[model samples]
Target chain A: MIDESRRVSMDIHYEISQHYFKEATYLQNWKLREWLSEMVDEEILYWMPIEENRLVKDRRPEPTPDDAAVYNDRYKHLKQRVEQIYTGQVWVEDPRSKIRYYVSNIEAFHTDVENEFAIRCNVLVLRHRRDTQIYQHSFLKEDLLRKTKAGFKVVRRKLTIDARSVQDKNLFFFM
Target chain B: MSDKDVAFISGAVRMYRERRGWYRSVCNVFMVGEKSRMEMRVMINVKELVDLENATQAKKIFWDQDIYDQEQERIFGRSWLFLTHDSLIPKNGDFVMSRMGEDKVIVSRQKDGSVEAFINSCSHRGNQVCHADSGNAKAFTCNYHGWVFGQNGDLVDVPLDTLCYHDNLKKAELGLRKVRVESYKGLIFGNMDPDAISLEEYLGDMCWFLDTILVGAGGGMELMGPPLRSVLDCNWKVPAENFVGDGYHVGWTHAAALQILGGPLAGLAGNRADMPYDDLGKQFTTRHGHGFGAINDAVTSIHPENEEYADFMAETRGVVAENLGTPREELYMSHWNCTIFPNCSFLYGTNTFKIWHPIGPGKIEVWTYTLVHKDLDIDVKRSIQRQAIRTFGTAGTLESDDGENMSTCTDSNRGFVTRKGRMNSTMGINREGRHPDFPGIVGASFIGETSYRGFYRFWAEIMDAPDWEAIKVQNDNWDEIWRGSEFWSDK
Candidate 1:
């Protein structure tokens, strides 16, 4: 179903995937400042709306920005979170927890905006803390990546977390 | 002075303080089990577990499975539990699945525009019906055996009813078990115990405090949902007690987040600043264990994005003063962290409504929603929702800090010696008493542990009382412990 105008070159697709992997590397290594300042667009919209379990027949529309969400972040919100971690008073993160990021299934398309690609990807995050505490999270992400002078910047990201009731103590970690 | 009766109070408690003998006098009421299970909780010698006099609770209360089972039946079964709010299920046939203890319930709006709830289990063979979190459906058809249940949990159809067994199924007797349902303001709650007091009565003086937020400016409040759900590995009571009156933990526990956000409460980070803490707030506890700690002029303390919410409070406080009077007006402009007895809790200023549903003694499932005034501008409501979720939702900055403390507090009791150990909440032992304007025990400061004492006081009372009848007898005398002191008058 690829339209001729929107299809991207294979070379561009490979570049975008590699860029996403590097972005994941910054987050997995807790280089949150670099992730924000380098990889994210200043006008980025990052959100994770609460997913409700409704019947297939239910016709209610998906949640908008006004509805409940786990993470509804602007650059400032993301910056505050990063600064919070760096404050050295975040005891929970101090007894440093281990984390790994798995990114795959990249499908990129050219959008109407010049140099902006609409991308869909799958992410699996694994976290382990304090001896036996282990949690796995999966998400399907829809992102808009802008090819700017600084390289690919995530302009917008909307993640659909797979868990109906998240099993972890908190989802404070980045996805 | 009402103040003349201050001799009975002490700042340090070395032994159980003597006041009213109501608890010790009720020995005859402590019977056990199938003489109506609500009539007794044999294993939980609540007197030893929750020592209100010393303000200490046994560590085992958080780890013991026997106590957890007793709670599942006695406390959970006999208490009014928070269910879905009407806003979430506004239309007829709209329903949401809820949990009361381990029991799954479907709360649905009926054809007559009233709400009804019933166990989600299929009446026959005990299979689960209606697995969706929420939906609009006339009937829930169980995949197994094709049994169908109506919106009110009435068993309507069965496969081969006429052909199989010649219609001996006795369909009328097999409706999913019904729970007594009631609404206070717009929030709906369910009670499994037939003998439990009406929801309004169960709410007790907590309603007086609730009116400050719920009915201030006349529109009342509603919970925004598709709530954020997550698991916390801690005793249900751990968080319950925290919200009840653990203001002590906030500055230290949430310091980083507060520092990053830099709101009015940022001064509280690390408890480093020696500010006028006592003058800032007060704590309150009702007859039925419901309680709150309210900080003066803190309505926008935690909200870094607090313009619209602050404006709403500024506009509404006068109207609330005109309607509910000056005392309530003060409450309207304050930040509050409260628990509605056994389980439900919320922060009014922060607007994060929560329910700590017990999974076992050492674990809980937390359901979070946004609480906002019904008639506010949609944009303002969304702003409050966003801020509330950002601070207290599953992925919240502050919530992450709390999860570790809660889990460790419960997990500590896993040690044999630790299980026998006792935890102290005697922060303001002699500091709270009756107030002329406030309807319950008003404490010296919001940071004090008075509400925790009051909370465990009722926990002991309920754990000992066999049924609501025994509870009713002492209802008039519930505040006997504070009967002699006059913090308001003396101060």
Candidate 2:
């Protein structure tokens, strides 16, 4: 009994929400290790502004690790970071012990392909560092969420804090 | 001799002898009294510092615990440290949290249109009262014990205070500890010491330099918050000193980044020999250690995509010339990488402002804000903010490039014996001297270390001054050290 437009909108919404829920659940359940091991085309293309305040030209070099050592170091560090979360490293979690990441205001757009849809959402993350203590509240993080077949992933997350200078204990939680 | 004269002479002699003695007696009574007096007598030398013109290694300004403690007392405690821009707290009851060294401070705009800052700790048991980074609030109630304080830092009410203290508790004594707050052209600064130098005097010649950007554009700038905060494993001084006048690093450290951007400065990557160096704008070092390295005619390069911003600066230059004269007018069009000594730094062209909050000897929390003209359209502000994040934010290409270097520099200096060796800052040694046109000492080129020398000169002065009184004596001698010919006279 649904109209064509309503039916199409509902279908798109369901598809986008399913992807988002899958990614959120994966991240919440600490499936980064499994995700990393998967053979899916996991290349991430990040485009940032150049010093000239414009989009980089074709001749402009791609964004890469600064040096070989830095690349190796960050790679190892990323692996270690994943492991620490899985192991419940108290230092990393202590500051963000209680956090609820709410991803909402989702909007879907078709990419170059019909099967693949680019999903965008507004995320608000709140953290209580310690139980019953309210001196330091984590700054709100605004991020851009994307959807893929594997799940919902952060394509570009921009953290817009409200203070001119952040007064948080530390930035240890993912937004 | 009279009894009073004898007592005075005896006390003076005892003090002098105790100071000279290799090992003074450690009696409990004498120790307590002597310790108290000794703490009071520890005078920091405000002048007479070793030259930093040849600094090669990273300086020990970051790792010295004694220096850190002294800075907390002398610099952070006494100076009018910058807090936030006025735009951040436009409405009454609007508040923002800031840091003075390690202590947290809450800056609020009151109903009377005056801004007030106070320690964030609760007056009752010293628990932090406000937890949010920034928000509009009529009152801040401590979460621990619900001790409520008004927007103006007055202890308005307490839960069951009549029942708890039975009217014995003094309300006046329990108010938040207030800090002296002032604003210069919309930039707010806080001071802990009542007798500290006025913000104008503390700024000194830096005001002339600041006016170039602050007062130049038809409308002054406002900070777009919240800031991008990230921890860097480096001494706070490294970044401050770098921004003060180290444009030399740009062509080298950011060569890869520049090549990626492919702007007008792309050819300068890898420091190509054909690149014009002398034609670049001159560098400057002021009496108060504020300095900048400016690139001539390249202001727009910092934000080329935003023609509105470039047009804004172009239009405002004439008004600034009328207000602040040609020196600052020229400065308005030039791309500047500058520092406001000790902690605050910003790029006028790039529109990125930062405060390096020291965590310890080898760590700092960098808070970055995008600066924009207050009168700019909302879309222009958004564009500027986007550009700022793409360049200076924690995940920005340039920021990441600099962060690794800063951390590595700090970590490498961890070798115990390596720290004893002094770093050299002597770039363009004997090349910088007094200039007629420029208000302060002028270096020949933007890459020169004239400002680094000036910064360390002040650093050493503060580190050495026996007390605040001693620092006052060197006010006259600040310009005497310069002995170079006036080069700016022709310009």
Candidate 3:
């Protein structure tokens, strides 16, 4: 009962979601450099912006990426971050936070660029560290994925958390 | 008289009053109020709390609830607290929510280019009137009961003006409490006490140092906000003292970070034994407790990855020297860890401005913003902002490296045995003196506690004095505390 075009599109969506799952696993396992090399494009942008509580009377979009952010990085900077974490010296993550990412609500759309699709999802990241309460962070994530020869590679990821202010002691764990 | 002699006389006076039963009579007549009674019982014993002679602070100061209450009343209630920068609310009616100590404040830019600030609590009921962080607004309406306050914090509208009260309510008198506000080079600060000194005077000799960064590079600085905010479970003073002068921790605490990043400070990584400790940098503290530790030629050192920022600073260094003099010219490119008394701190090179707003004795809400030169090219400003956040923002590597220590430093004081202990800050005690070119006491090395001693000295001075008038009496004698040694005479 399934047409070939519809089946192929559904398959691509499933493949993208699967790719995301693998990427999350890599991050959770503290295999950051491996994830960067195997799953991300050479020209990737990873950004996590600070959210502000705005009044309804002064409605405005969230701050731009160019504005201050928690993590705003290009491929080179992201690699540097991986190196910093792996140095066994960044005291913040000497014993890294145990983090699990619950990625859901996946939606995909084709971009004008070749073999590229814009994927949107909602994620809930639960992080536990150093005998403290488990920090719950709910965020909306948007990823630009390219259909490379080896499957899908993330070209951009923008994460916007729900709260105006972060409650976590540190964002040592990637969401 | 010696400080100890004055203390002895005061103790004798107290004993005499107690022996004659006059103390109780005086309490009955003058301190009948519950608040005054509580204050009297928990009055800060300056001599016991801070031993300037030993450069050791009683750990109780970090965990005692009573001392924290007095600080809220005497220190934060009277200090010039940083509110917001002119760039944050440049236009008329633009407002930002900030805190002065534990009290929430709303700072607004008026139509006339002047700024105004007010307590965010509603006059009718104790509800927060403004919840938004920063925005342009004609008025703020209380969500609880719909009492509207204008941009200037005047009561503009009441939900039931005529029908409910029949003009019985004095709307004119039911306005938000106005906070005294002033600006220095585009940085706005608010004070609850009207009798407090002007912002410039409060800053004092620190201005000569601040101008090197704030007024450098063609124009002054601007803060990039909606700041990154996070709560730190630590006593406010822990971070304040750290930022005031904690360079000793940098090469040790952030050794791994600096080494992996391979910046100018990378040489200090892992406490490298061969590193020249004394020649690294110097520290200075002013009369009002404002202080900084300067690491020579390390400005833009944290941003090794940002070429544009490095180039921008390299270009601006000459102009800054021309504008601020050679002494400051040298400081123009030096990295600085500084604190402006009570709770504002910023790293001049790191460019992370922080306000440690105390929630209680054991907790502080850290609000951080990136500081940038206003006149720099937009790209350059953005680059600096990015690099600053990457290294020192709310989730920054260096910031995270410090959070655990700050929290543990305060939380451990809850132990009765721990609270009774003393914390030492005697590094470079007799090794600091007046700088020939710079104002205030200058230490021989950056990694020293000269500023810590000065900070607590002023803190005790303020807490012990009954009023500003009483404090002024000791103005001429302030520097005498460190007069025994003239260590920096040759410099």
Best by lDDT: 1
What does candidate 3's lDDT look like per residue over B103-178, in tens digits? 9999998889889899999998889998888899889899899999999999999988899988788888988999
In CAPRI terms, model 2 is classed as incorrect
The TM-scores, one per candidate, come to: 0.93, 0.73, 0.92
Error of 2 at B374 (Å): 2.7
Q: Classify candidate 3 by CAPRI docking class.
A: medium
Greater TM-score among 1 and 3 belongs to 1
Give me the runs in candidate 3 sitting further than 4 Å from their true place.
Answer: A1-9, A59-61, B1-37
Query: What's model 1's lDDT at A145?
Result: 89
Candidate 3 chain B has its poorest 10 consecutive residues by lDDT at B35-44
Q: Give fnat of each prediction, in order.
A: 0.93, 0.03, 0.69
* Residue ranges of candidate 2 with Cα displaced over 4 Å: A1-175, B1-59, B484-491
- What is the overall TM-score of model 2 with all chains considered together? 0.73
Which digits, one per residue and each the tens of the lDDT, describe model 1 over residues B1-491? 24333322221111232212334335335533234533333535678898877889998888888788788877898999999888999988999989999899999999999988999888877888988999898998987898998888888999999998589989988888998999998899999999999999999888888888878899899999988999889999999999998888889999999898787888889887687888879999999999999989998777866687788788888899999999999998889999998999999888999999999888899999999889889988888888889889998989989999999999988898888899999988788998888898989889899999999999888776667766876766788888878667956
Better of 1 and 2 by lDDT: 1
Give the best candidate by DockQ: 1
lDDT of 2 by residue, B335-420 (tens): 88888877999887778899998888778888788887787788777777766665566545356457656765676666788765
Cα displacement (Å) at residue A161, model 2: 11
Query: What is model 2's DockQ versus the real complex?
Result: 0.06
lDDT of 1: 0.87
